[model samples]
Target: MSSQYRTGSRGSAKAKVIALVGAGALLLTGCTAEAKRGWLPNVERDTTNHTGAIQDLWVHSWIAVIIIGVMTWGLMLWCVVAYRRRKTDTGYPRQLSYNLPLEIFYTAIPLVLVLVFFSFNNTVEKSINAPVDSEVVVDVRAKQWSWDFNYNYEGQKKYFAGEQAHLNTDGSAGVEETLPTLYLPAGKSVTLELNSRDVIHSFWVPAFLQKLDMIPGKTNYIYLTPQVEGTYAGKCAELCGEYHSEMLFNVEVVNDAEFKAQLAKMEDGHIGEEYDRQPNKVNSVVVEHGHEEGGK
Candidate 1:
């Protein structure tokens, strides 16, 4: 009786520790806030997409996760309690080998669960990968440390961002500045064609939850929607060059009127050209020495 009581007490303590550990693990993976200015927003953090289908699928998958977790813990505890070693422990555990039926049952159950999970996952993948007939498109190219966004608002009617343009400036410290801000009208299905100039680079937007690889020769595609109205920071995901951490772009999702106005302003002003010209003008002062030449 004493041995049985002691075993029960030990089992209780073990179960409490296991529960605490599990809870701690879950808490570690729980939500914590960050600066939200990109493809991922501060509000919707779990499995977000432009269409929100991926998010829905994730919710279903987590249900399975919870169910499986409970079953696993239950089974583990059952085995532990049933086969625990007492004070006068025997030489070895019971000689009961694995049962074929039980093994098959376990295999089949998990297989079926996996298939169910995959069905939802596959559905989402296919839906997302489906051909977009009227999807808005953008081309993107990335090089060492700059991002150039070119929107084809002319004859082709295909808008693209990320063209690998070599930035040249008079100064040697930093290269010329390319397109800094990306403008997109909200509620439009924008597609981006991604490429790399020098090395591999990744264009990632936290709010839009979209990322595309900019390969040397190959162009990749990233599809997303601007769900909300804001300015989001685009970060480089791949370790391309020296300024990996400093490599960042901007995505601005605004209304159609706002986008058109911004584009019109850019066209009329030629901001980039003006920016380049201003620097040369500022540094073009020729210093002439007349009497100071011999005096010094």
Candidate 2:
């Protein structure tokens, strides 16, 4: 009777474990598309050229790490169970001072893994950063707490001077009307020439899975093709100043007609000489204040 009870308890425990695991898997499977994509921003893979490649790299890297982790942990658990010290054991099992083959295997395996990751990363980086004869060129000027976008197309330039974003008491950033916007035509190649009028800032769009720094006295560039028509949130990734958190912008990927219409509206408002010819003078007062605060 006791043996039967023990057997029944073991069976019940295993059933409970199996049921729990099944339930968890069901929940995972029922998750939204965003959750399944590891909580990444909702981006259409087919439309967005780089999104699919980046997401694949990210997911594959995690899968590889998980496989290695499980193997390592299983080996450790097996060693503990199979070769653990026992009461009948008289002395230490055979001990080895060196394991040449094992050492070479472990070292080589990690090196190979690193090389594989590096190769994939390099390929993606090159593909994304490769220069293209872009249809649109945007000069993105980041300032103390605002943004300035200059759109250059067909020998004409239009500019929008964005105001500093207002922060809620809870410190959340949102799409406010005053915030500047960048418009790109879907299915067209675009290049963003990143510049800083004052200190350093970073242009980050989470959905794009990339960010680049804007350093004063230097110019950087980002090359991409927007294939999906949507509004994506953008923000400064680097900590610049007191209102760095409010350094936000919006990217609107639209059809070619809409993009051209938007630029046409800004035709009368051309890029100013202060911002275009003299980038440093756009916000000299704020820049000086930032420098003083930094010295303190």
Candidate 3:
């Protein structure tokens, strides 16, 4: 009996050592490997006007989550190995009914964690939705499965209305999937007023790290700044209708001179009367251009 007890104890100790070594290796691998490639592995890469601030909050949140996850998993593994049934056990191990201190610790810790997370999220949300002195305002209208972007420049109503792009009829792929391009000056604040014509739709610019819903009879606002000088993709994030997949758009961030030139060109009888202006109203006309009343 003494020999059997000694042998069983030795085996259990060896098993525990192996488990600890494996757990340590996993922790080291996860930390070093993911750290090399930015800590938050699942978040979208940010390139919007004020997305840097949001990105900071996002990274910190993920770090907190990972730390809690590791600790919780470590405790579970430790409990499994440390209090496991042994082959050399006689009748039963000493079992405690309950510990008030441990119970309170578990309950209180989670509550504190929840509050901390909530506060962090609230701060980030406020920062994202904060108002800014906008240099330009674009009224965005969603209908069926398409987006209409009306740009108001220098106190003038939409001098140019942007809609979905069309491919050349020659069957050649010239600029594949290029949709309505909304031009804005980089490093300037721009406000977008979102309104839906018929059904609900979402305006999402993944690079901007911003999205807002457009509901009928209600106007939603999205304020953002574009910092990059390239075209970024935008899309209707919500499934609205049969052609929902075709609801795609583009955002072109340009320099101040180029932005002004584009607006000037649009005002100089370039867009023509067919692409004429419209009143900026939340509950106004929702007809596509040329399909309007008595429009050619």
Best by lDDT: 2
Model 2 clash tally, residue pairs: 0
Model 3 clash pairs are 49-225
Give one clash count per candidate, in the order shown: 17, 0, 1
How well is each residue in 1-296 modelled by candidate 2, as lDDT tens digits? 69999999999999999999999987886476556655444666754578788877877888888999999999999999999999999977998999999999989999999999999989988988888889899988887777878888878788776767787777675546667788888998889889876688999887787789988778888888888888888999999989887888888999999998998887444442244324434433434213311110
Tens digit of per-residue lDDT, candidate 3, span 1-296: 69999999999999999999999987787667435454554233446656777777778888898999999999999999998989998898888999999999999999999999899888878877888778798777776655566677677555444444444577443544456667888888899888776677899877676788887678889888777788877888998877676667777889999988777665422222232223354244427644432111
Worst 10 residues of 3 by lDDT: 268-277
| Global lDDT of model 1 | 0.61
Residue 255 of model 1 has an lDDT of 85
Q: Which has the higher lDDT value, candidate number 1 or candidate number 3? A: 3
After TM-score superposition, what is the CA distance of residue 195 in candidate 3 from its true location, in Å? 1.2
What shift in Å separates residue 230 of candidate 2 from its native position after superposition?
1.3
Over 4 Å off, model 1: 1-32, 35-51, 86-91, 154-179, 267-296
Alpha-carbon RMSD to native, per candidate: 12.0, 7.2, 9.7
What would the TM-scores of all predictions be? 0.65, 0.78, 0.72
